[model samples]
Target: MDNDCMNNIEDRKIIYQLINFAIKHKKIMQNYLDETGVYQAQHRLLMEIFHNQNASQNHIVKSMDVSAATIAVSLKKLEKGGYIKKEMDEVDNRLNKITITEKGKKVVEQSKQIFDSVDGRVFEGFTEEEKLTLFLLLQKLNDNLNSMEDELKSKKERK
Candidate 1:
């Protein structure tokens, strides 16, 4: 096989591995979330509110880059579960200010422990140097993907 063809095949194999890794990681996370009774979407929304206390739904939609309807649904579920409380904005009565409840704070702390445990297990056999090297490589890959996205946006804007 030619050099270019060989390179393309190697690239494909790397991408396939990356995709599989993401899927498996997501599955494991979902399973953990299920056992904790914290759906992924609700967990994310709860955490956002927990950190940003009194955040508006619109602000969360923008920060998360998700549709308002999607955020609304998740917020509703979170509120119903007593994980969050929504009050009308004092100045802007049309908007609801979201705040994480005490229960939500506990959940956030629990989630952190769960994530740390998962990371420990995932990197159990790796040495410190190996872990650092893997982190650096993953960061480089993330930066490349961000650059490509920016380039695509620039091209589209130019058109």
Candidate 2:
């Protein structure tokens, strides 16, 4: 059987392959996180704040696709580690704006290098066209999943 044809299998083998790849990818990502002295969610949280210092907890919750409680816990941990600081919004006392500390900036730099190396290694042999095609396919996969999730949520809310 042609390797390309294997992707067309309709017996759910593709799902299994995707699941296996996710597991392996998580392991590799964990190794990168191990060097950063931050947990997976914490690293993401830091990067989000680094990119958008004006981000509020609500914004983080939506952007990270994580529960509000998860963001709170991660924020608390990051604050304790001196990697981030949350200050009351000047315009709105009820909301807090997140900011990355100088220490967090250093962590971001190190984590960037590590992740860049990981990406380089992962796509070592791929040409530029292959990379674009892979990204496009992945985006389509994500769109399909998101649509399914929205449908499920709507159905659940109706019951």
TM-scores of all candidate predictions against the true structure: 0.87, 0.83
Off by over 4 Å in 1: 1-9
TM-score of 1: 0.87
lDDT of 2 by residue, 5-90 (tens): 87677747767877998898889988877888999889988999999887999998998899999899999999999999899999
Task: Please give the lDDT score at residue 34 for candidate 1.
Answer: 76
| Ten-residue stretch with the least lDDT total in model 1 | 5-14
94 Cα displacement, candidate 2 (Å): 2.5
Evaluated against the true structure, the overall lDDT of model 2 is 0.91
Model 1's number of clashes is 0
Give the runs in model 2 whose Cα sits over 4 Å from its true position: 1-11
Q: What TM-score would you give candidate 2 relative to the actual structure?
A: 0.83
